[model samples]
Target: MAGGRAPRVLILLCILHLHCLQGAKILTISFVGGSHYLLMDDISQILQDNGHDVRMFYQGYQNMQGYEKTSVPYAVSTYNMEEKYLKAYDELFHEYQREIFISRDRPQSLFPLMTLYAKHCRLYMNQTDILDFLKQENYDIAIVDPFNPCHFLIVEKLGIPYIAFFAGPFSYSLGNGLPSPPSYVPMYLSGFTDRMNFLERVINTFMYLGSYMVEIRNEEIFSGVIEEHFPPDSRPTLSDLYNKAELWIYNMDFSIEFPRPLLPHIQCISGLRAKPPKSLSQDLEDFIAESGDSGFILVTLGPIISAVYRMDFIKEMNSAFASVPQKIIWQFKVSQWPKDLKPAPNLRLLDWVNQNDLLGHPKIRLLVAHGGLNGLTEAVYHGVPVLGIPLFADQPDNIVRIKAKHMGEYIPFYEIKSDKFANMIQKLIKDKSYKMAAMKQSVIMRSRPFPPDQQLLGWVEHIIRSGGGGHLRPYSYQQPWYQQLLLDVILFIFSCVALLIYIIVKVIRFLIHLLYSRKKQKQN
Candidate 1:
């Protein structure tokens, strides 16, 4: 009996230990462009390395080193190339892009594109082949970037846990309030700026108002697509979509982000940047060594912003580099440099370059960029001050925040003249404020209690440790903006005060009239 009891206890202990080991199949869908995949790849790699199985879905290849990737079932090729819908999509994309470039504050402008993107994502999710694959694979949780909101919704509908990877500084991760960052007014305690100048607060309020409207419209558009594709019974209401979000891993650091509101289910695990390769190419090494100590500025507009679109700016940049003592390293994808433009002694241009490693080096002094979130992260990670030449989309918002933090300077893409560019570079290079601000942010980023990659793993594993989507519910989106702000209470009190004033005035008039009449009669 004693020997049997000892064996039973040992078996029970083993079972408990096995139960504690959290190993689940994580399905990730990354259907956006190269920059979006940067965020996706980081999270997926972290999960896979931490004893979890990951199946990654991708539309395009950006980071192609050594990661397992499964192609999205139907990408751009499968779509019927009907002129009307294609034109409609193109027009919408252009309009949105234009709005992002010129608008003073347009946080919700991306919703229209997001809805169109969601429609295509749903189209792919509908195919019979995908249905078959879905039925065969057993997944525990599906982590998707919010840009591909439909896939996450599908995971939620399946009663599996789903998480969103925030690619930039958007408030979508802050809950169902809106897709923009928290109101830029009164500056959240942990915001990048110390105080909102009058103009900035006004702009922030406009953004808040605009974001509310956009979220309402996006919900309608998002729900309509689901209703059109899936049966009424199969789809969840907009409320259900936000509620199913088990965790949101933000690719932002607290130093750069405003103070976050409480959403117990939401988790912030930002600064998950891709690490640079161990060594640099010979050409790059030679260029770094030849710069003669003063170092250089790395100018890039990322992979999406074609050099052709930015050729004029490059001309200005070339003119600017002519005067500066510092050398310049440009990540040029195009083959042709303008005929009139002569390559300077201190200038070098490469088709493709390692941006992160370049920024990390002690030789690189300033970064002139298009202000994509990835580039911003890199500049901050290396404590390099920047001159933001924002193009479109979130670039404007990113630059504004970048400028607000005093970490860099910003110039509109079209307005960058050679003289202006050169002068700006000279100011940034000579001034210590910009460098100090960047270094401060970098320290804050590094000082986080846990590494961002590890933090992401912990939050993901926590979701698995708990049950999937069961912990988070969808009641947060129920109230409208007016009600949430208690505008009704203000209206009610104002109405009561007005009514009381009217009643008092009427009573006083009546009393005066009666007294006048009585006095007149007595005199008569």
Candidate 2:
């Protein structure tokens, strides 16, 4: 009877332990498409795996964004945004790309697209039903994509504590009292790495200051939405909302990115997506095997680029691929390929390839890419070297880091000559050091004390269980800009030193005059 009682007591204790750790309700928001949705979806999936109820809300202009998530474990709410503004923005971008490649002009700051962004925000707030569902649900915490200022507004309206999942560089966190020294930390769109000379540093500093101007413009973009939807008395600036985020998990890993200063609340989750790849499809296997010992290059210019970019770019790429001895697996649209041009003999054009799987294949020589963070992270994980033909966005600087690390090289979009492109590919294939460097980075990425998935899961749960990450936040956010920078303290010290020097000069002058006067009187 005593033994039976002991077993029952153990069962009760186990039940009690399970009851103590209840799963927290999490709401994730993703309004932007592509990588933004991918990151947020992954976050929601992970939370659900841990027995939490996760609801992901997606609103965007792009229709084709979320279809890739075929096995989502979380509940999702989606809203299709009006595309009137996006159509106009696309026209401007199309023209902008034309100007850069056709005119042989130097690259400049991209179009602001403020109107397009603002319109999306307005449309998103107009979703009364979705907003009502979110409000009724009463989520414990919200994980938002700060890419669209609209998601921030939604979270603010709901009055829930939030975290950020960002794909941009560290410079974006500058406004939130995060340390972003311009000397090393490059501007988000500057396309520069940490290592810069005197002139580059000057440019980087100016670009850093220019980011504030861009933020001011971003505020202007969202001002109308706030005025139209929210109460007049409590207008929340997008910049202010960005500052209040309890934690930020970037879609970046140190394996590819340069090291920079990050706070306790700020962390990177790049290594989480790096998985041991599965086998490719049978057709893909046959294509990869055709290269034999020579190997094949994997080219994916991202989904958007393949569809929008002109045929001249394709022609140049094709000409280059034709020159190389190795086979090429290029991710491009079959429908977009012009019938007038002859396809490269060694090239296989696929609408989609298991990019991660291809990168993991032993025969993958080097990745011919646009230098997006996702593919770069995968390449580093699999120890595959990259050679990027950077088109736009952060691709230039992303490639800059790859070149700096000596694991890869980058060619400007305007400079894709057949001979030069082919030569670069040959160099990468022949060079053993690039492969070694990539492998070293892979080892570093996987060899962390705690793997990236554990870090991501632990920190998020830590925040959820504690109600918020208020304890991890530094008191610096509450301080004024001058105080945060220690500008006032600097001025005080400078003023005291100046006063002391002034007094010393005055005393010395007076003493000198008195001595001279006495000496002159004696002489007289």
Candidate 3:
């Protein structure tokens, strides 16, 4: 009877543990871009596969028809504000392109562009219908891309813990209260590596501070919007709310990124978008096979900037491609080819191509890209050298890192003469060192103990099981900025040093006076 009872007790405990691991209601939010949406979709699918109920709220101009194919349900809200933002983005892209190529000094201030994005996010959240839907969901957790603080407000209103899903390298703002000394870690968008000279450090520090200032300004703007939507008592500052995230999953790998200290709550989830190379269409396969000894080059500017380049620039690129001996596969935006410009028989232009699939091909020699993170990761994964033509955002930084690693070179768009472009392409193709370095980095990137997707799923499930994983958050999160920076300690030390100096000076003066008095008395 006793043995039977023990077995029953064990079985009952097992049942309880299974029940505890049941599905959770997850809410995901992100701004609408192909790369952003794809990342969020991957996250949602992973959670849903594990028996979690996942829903998404996205804002942007891109069509959401792609979501229909996914099992996870999502809602997209686009207002007239998207058109305004798109127009602004187009103008900014052109301006940035010109600044990168034509001007000696590129504009340092990204505050205005960041502010515009913040306003667009606010507009999306302020919609009554969107807010109502979010409220109705009764979500258990909110996973948000912290590009803007507006999602923090949404999660606060929903009354649930949220996670920060960084789509790029770990952001400095996300490391608030944590020990990320700028002495080593490069500031986002600074394009400097960890190794820096005195001047570079000064510039890096200024850029770091500037980014924080921008964040603070946006926070104030967002705070007013949050206050308007919620009761005064319930209104939470964006800074306070942002730090409340239970976990931070940054799309960074230490192998690729500079070494930096991270709190326990932060996890690196880089290369989640990477997957096994898929089969290319028969035509593409045949094209690569026909490339013969001199392999092909793949060129793409990613999805957003496909239409941003001017025709004259496109013509110049075409001319450069004509000069190169290697076969070229260029992903251009327009279907109609330019009538006047003639390309070499080896050049092929297409509207779209399976980028990863092409990179993984043995006949492919190099990649010419805009340095988007996804494209960079693919090139690195396949061990292909790159010639980056960076435009804006993280592109410049990404290219700088690639060059630092000796994996590629970049050509400024304004300097895109046919001879120079052809020579650069030829150099990358002929140089075995670039290919070797890329292959070495590829080993490091792929050496993780587990697959990236599995690692992500495991951490996410851990968070869900532990109910927001609050214990993982560091004590630093609650500390004041001065405390976090040890500024108070520095001030105390400075005061002590000043007091010691004063006492030493006073004693010296008294001794001098005593000696002078003695000397005068003797003389009398």
Candidate 4:
């Protein structure tokens, strides 16, 4: 070959290589309140790091707002968290475990409550705005957490591949019969923990059905607006939305989360756990170095729950730590220490410190947390056992999983007196079992084929490279559950048997009528 031809051939190969490595520029749209964004942001960064473009469209409220004005490529949608919503959420979260919908107790009760709560923060929020943003950007695929089932319809309109990101302990696959997480600790049983019994399952079923209604409503609202505003060839249903999606990136590991049958499209990528920030400030470093190996306890109630209960928990924890020989590092996120409550020699409080770093530090032994999944992941990541004080939603479920794994112990939030808190702390630290369990999980969690961040990128690349294969679509509710169980055939047989019985009865009546007419003639 000529020299010029060689260069041309090389150029062709390079282009082929680039095309082979081609990944879709993923556009992630997440709701405000849920912790979905935390996982999505990590996925987004991984995509970006691998030379794939990412654009985030989030309602600038709550934690999502923290990324605002940062160098990340993102756009803020019209949803903003109002003061009233925050106040109302605070009130609800205080008793969240009592009120969370495990099943359909009411129509549009659980989801609408959450959406309405979110809407109270931002009024003019519509599904169209999100669609319009998607249409303009022309994203290759849309990654959404299933909680925002409303947004799934956006993918149907644009004919794009979408994957619902499940970012918690639970799993929801199409073919999985119904949406049931491994186990949920009953709200009524505060002390004794067990799986949802028959009644709870019935209620949970109702709640799931109610969520379906909300999904339909959301689809109608979105499709109706699409029909009004833009030209549409065909309107899409909720089923259509599921069909168009390519995959479900379940944010859980099989090792940590129990094995459940999942759809072909669903893949477990649970390793993408996170802590606030790993790097500590100079003051934190100095504090850790000067602690003289007393082994501090890192206390945090999580972000939302922290706002309400932090001060009280801090005071009680302080009281408990007074007798213990260990130091205390409280993650308060504010410098407003009570003037009267002077800092003890062993106690240091900061508004915010790198949570993972604190856990990984040699000086830190135990974590006092509200049992959020992220905190649990970090605790497990560093092999530090927890004294879980769960607040709401999946916190109780998470704590149950933690304790079941033998990695941690849980104390009910209502039972968080100083003495009890101190006893639990002492039990976790002094006992070798908790750390051993955590270390076992850590070893298994680390032994995975790839880091969660890289695994996430691979899935996205697969979508782009395969041009969004239909094979990756989740089989959720696709097969009539009746068909799967051979119930349809059973019903057909029952109907046929009934028809045969009816025919026999009709023939018998006809014969009797004829016999009666003959007898009347003879009498005449």
Candidate 5:
């Protein structure tokens, strides 16, 4: 009886072992902006909660403090960009910001800055310690933020299947080979809506082509970096690695994003970061209570922007806030406040605030933001209208979408006159339409088929269980450019028709000539 029981126990142990092995070992790569890190952290958290073993490799220039309490195991590498590269980056960032404010168009030259970042990422990945650690780790799948193309190569070198994780709306590079006709699906940086006139469509088409060319150039830059870090003979090309991705998870939703075609493997986990409103701090609560029926406004430009340094902008904002009846909570990051610049008595300045929590508060009437994706999503989640002060990158496009939805209005930084700013704020607060539209979008955004976390985890598990879901990848991705566009087929059909018409004309000419010759002979 003891021996029979031991045999049954062994069978039970084997079953337990199989169940444990079913849990995937996931590796996540995140870099650069705070927003990107936040999105990746959310994903890592969900993956780990579902019993998978998740590890992350994070490298960023700033905002490392945000991930201090994360449970997922991680190896962090900082570029130490502050020591040497900060000045250059600051100059570029502000310059680009100014350009966007003035022109409200895509920056003329982003390739230089892109290549600079690529070089830094390549340098970090080539470190002996990082390389060895990554090589030893056994991972079933890699979820990468493809903001830097170098990450794709890193996953490829480790011989793991990967999924592209974008922190914002699907851009041109990520949406490549996916059907996003420019006529309807606006270009990433074009700042156009889905509803476009003929001129806008023509511009969208050109912008699409231009963006593609830039991607090609950047790919070439990344290819050289790959060759330097890995063996040239056996390594795959950048395009090959890009096409090899098993899935794509975009931090976007149809509610806030333009409708476009997408592959089955692509998923949208838009408001995953949004949570139920938490109780405000004692001081915050007191401030809101003091405001009474007037409510309060929240102003933040996010992590990268140096809003404190822009004295002129600050003065204009101060003037505008002074005229308003509502109290204000401004997240300004300066050590010493300028004595000469007097803010409104109703304004309260702090170094940081829990933006999501503040947005959810019932007493908070308006959000003044840099039009970042995370901020916009949070505002939409809480049904709060925004007064957009767009600076650069996707900010313009975000504001355009807000206006189209009638959820808000935007004032470019360069055009921020005190009266105009004040009036916009007043319009947002007094008008019920903006609030109604925001609530409508919030409803749509929250009405996902499944909770965002569950959706994210389910898709990730699907990829691992299905062995990278290679069958879901579009065949068009593997085809030549002409063939994928059907230009070759169109050309073939046109040639055949032209040849048939030519042959008919020749036959008719010959018959007419013969008849004319016979008639002349009969006359003779």
Candidate 6:
């Protein structure tokens, strides 16, 4: 394996070296937390590894796990947010997540999240010193996490080109002018399959319209920040700034996701951070060995959702894991675990897990996840089936795709019980079909003509070399909705046809009246 990889490694370096300038300074922004920042961190590291002077600006709401300046190869700068914003974020999300989402009827969550991100935009713009420092960096281009529009606002202020980095399935491209036909394409968080029935299609259409409504609300949320920071005449509209991205790098792959139309400017670099399994620690290895032929299950509900893990939920999961023969390696922090409940005999709970590396283990039978894109992508790369218990945001929507692909099944959090949860786990592990499906998806994932890193390095350098990706973007981006969809032209044709028919009918009636009058006079 090492021998075969050497040539490909050298070729990749040569390809990247061709575009390598005298160390082009690249700036990356991460305004959101969790997997969003993780994706940017990996991207920044890749660029730095390829000899670019990469720097990451990290700030997040309420200091969630994975929000800290993680150990990465690139330089990182930090900005502290005010206590008021942190307090507000805590009060809002904790209550909302517990009360609304925990109820599990798919309540409206877009507006609340948007409102929080908008507040962060205001907070980000208030950092005059950071803005001035960024202006002096003179970066060739910036990579913005479009999750928070403020990330782009900073890049716009610096007056450099930027690429939008989407962390997948949150439907950022829809409002940013991707051609999403509602008939078959499902909206983010709608939880409908790509192949939809008539009722599903109707709901999908409304969900598409709801996306526009969300965008409008998002604009309203951020209008204050733009007004306060940018000058009147020089102010940029939200749509223009969103569409201004030279390229879009999505954390999505067609193998796991439904096939959809994408532009040349858009690229999928899913599972770019994945690596083969490393040797497990002695204790963990011993535990896996005890499971013997059954292997083990890896479970993580993400950092945010795990913090809210209820004791009853943990007990139920524990009972289910006990019922299974497969040893469970669950990523549960011991500090937050309830004193009343003990872990099952077959399970081992760890505070921190090397998830990607663990997924690639030789004996990894299944992954039990919260359906986050990062985890799911790793599962796809490792050819491991998943049993998703989705909670909030894109989690539910993501699991829908997972189940649709036949790699795994999902049990709604509110509906999870010991019996049903154990059955699903056994089905995913015992059934060879799910494993076969997962391996097939992995083949598709790895079958891309060029690896994701090459695609990233290649496209990023091409964009910088050409100053921007404006040439790659289609001309349809500049057209208004009426012209782009040809709605006005259709209306014009319809009206003209109607008018011609009306005129023809009127002419025929008049001729018939004249003929009748002539016939009456002759008869008299």
Candidate number with greatest lDDT: 6
| Model 5, runs deviating above 4 Å | 1-22, 64-82, 85-108, 173-175, 304-308, 521-524
Please write out the lDDT profile of model 1 over residues 254-359, one tens digit for every residue: 6665554545556666667734425777877787787777788898876434423445756777788988988788876545566666776778877666778888
* After superposition, candidate 6 runs with Cα above 4 Å error: 1-22, 60-70, 105-107, 506-524
| TM-score of each prediction | 0.78, 0.90, 0.85, 0.75, 0.90, 0.91
Model 2 pairs in collision: none
Give candidate 5's TM-score.
Answer: 0.90
Summed over model 1, clashes come to 0
Error of 1 at 32 (Å): 0.9
Residue 47 deviation, candidate 3, in Å? 2.2
**lDDT (Cα, tens digit) per residue for candidate 6, span 1-524:** 99999999999987786656638889999877667877888899899999899988887442444334456789988877778877887777777667634565342565687778877777777788888898898999899888778887888878989999888664886767887899988887788988999999999999898888777877888888889888999988788898899998888888878888888888888887776778889999999999889999999887655567676677889999999999999877667777888889998878778898889898899999999898999999999999998887778888989899899999877778999899989988899999999999999998889888888888888888877998878898788878987999999999999999999999999999999999999999
**lDDT of prediction 5:** 0.78
lDDT of 2 by residue, 240-284 (tens): 788788897787777778888888888888755668889888888
* Model 4 residue 104 distance off true place after TM-score fit, in angstroms: 16
Model 2 scores a TM of: 0.90
RMSD of each: 6.1, 4.2, 4.1, 6.7, 4.2, 5.9
Give the distance in Å from residue 156's predicted Cα in candidate 3 to where it truly belongs: 2.0
Query: Candidate 4: TM-score?
Result: 0.75
* TM-score result, candidate 3: 0.85
Screening candidate 3 with a backbone cut-off below 3 angstroms (N, C-alpha, C), the clashing residue pairs are none
**On residues 1-524, what C-alpha lDDT tens digit does candidate 4 reach at each position?**
59889999999997996775654567776664435776666677777777766777665554421223345644344455567766665566444433432331232334545555334323323455655666787777878776555456445555556777777654234322333442442221122234567777666555544554655665554454445433566655555555556776666765456545555666788757643346677877787677576678888775544444445655776788776777788765454556567666777766555577788777778988877677778887778888887765557667777887888888765556778878888888889999899889878877788887878877877777677746654353477757867898999999999999999999999999999999999999
